[model samples]
Target: MNQSSTPQVPFWAHLLCGWPLFLVAVGGAVGGGLGGLAYGISISIFKTNVPMPVKIIAPVFIGMAAVVLYFVIAVAIFTAIQ
Candidate 1:
């Protein structure tokens, strides 16, 4: 087929290839930051006994888990669409 006449890859192809990774990276960063912020605020406001490192690390780990969950969901949806 001529290059111009060839069918372009569907939008979903790009989404399937890239969107989950992007979302996870973004979600992890956001979740980590928010988690740290919330921990800091709670510690200052409520005087929680949790350690600073735990507060900072918990969110990052949770965020990573969330990203994995998100990927699974996305894959399911993508499969259904196909």
Candidate 2:
């Protein structure tokens, strides 16, 4: 018995080549997951241990960063596959 030699598909091949709508959903999930994680960590960790000014500003900045991160990651994934 013999087997034909074909290059193995990369693990991410489907992710990079699947339906466009599916990719968008995946990207949004990943970005939202990470962004929410970051925000949660910031709120939990910096809630009470920080100085007054830091307490007021850190969460806001972290939240903004999370939003930016979400958008950036989503855009990057969508663009990369394009």
Candidate 3:
């Protein structure tokens, strides 16, 4: 077997960077999922019982709130862990 002449990267560097990056990625995914879930719930809740303006506006606000909440929570958790 012939060995390539390219330099090898250190494992510690990969570990140090990889874990946090992985966590951040997972956090973002979870956050987006939770936001979508909140949007769905908000849609169900606002479908028939609210005023037209409220029906149009409340879910958007709710989804935004959910996304912000998720982002904050995820960052907090990631920071805490690291």
Candidate 4:
């Protein structure tokens, strides 16, 4: 039996760098998932009592943040690599 040692990959490194389209797609999926989760939690507790603005804004912001994060991370990684 032979044993080899290698450091485990960090979560941030694993996620933040990849093919451009794939990264963006991942961001969209993650954003959608987060938005759904937030909605579920909010409705469960608030039961339509949550304000109209809050419901509409939360998902939009989360989605936008995911897109921005994808670009920012890609640029940062590209700069660091070069």
**Model 2 ranges off by over 4 Å:** 1-28
Off by over 4 Å in 3: 1-29
| Number of the candidate with higher TM-score, 2 or 4 | 2
Question: Mind giving the per-residue lDDT tens digits that candidate 1 earns over 42-63?
Answer: 3333233466566445544544
Which residue pairs clash in candidate 2? none
Local accuracy of candidate 3 as per-residue lDDT tens digits, 8-72: 43454233222223223445677546655665565455535556577556656665666577768
Per-residue C-alpha lDDT of model 2 across residues 1-82, encoded as one tens digit per residue? 8765643434343222222323235456765565556555555544345575774556556655666676787688789999
* TM-scores, each model vs. reference: 0.42, 0.52, 0.54, 0.41
* TM-score-better candidate, 2 vs 3: 3
After TM-score superposition, the amount by which residue 6's alpha carbon in candidate 1 deviates from its true location, in angstroms, is: 60
User: For model 3, where is the 10-residue window of minimal lDDT?
Assistant: 13-22
Task: Give the better candidate number (3 or 4) by lDDT.
Answer: 3
RMSD per model, one decimal: 19.5, 17.3, 18.7, 15.5
* Best-fitting candidate, scored by TM-score: 3
Question: Which candidate ranks first by lDDT, i.e. highest?
Answer: 3
lDDT of each: 0.47, 0.53, 0.55, 0.46
lDDT of the structure predicted as candidate 4: 0.46
Candidate scoring better on lDDT of 2 and 4 = 2
The per-prediction tally of clashing pairs is: 0, 0, 0, 0
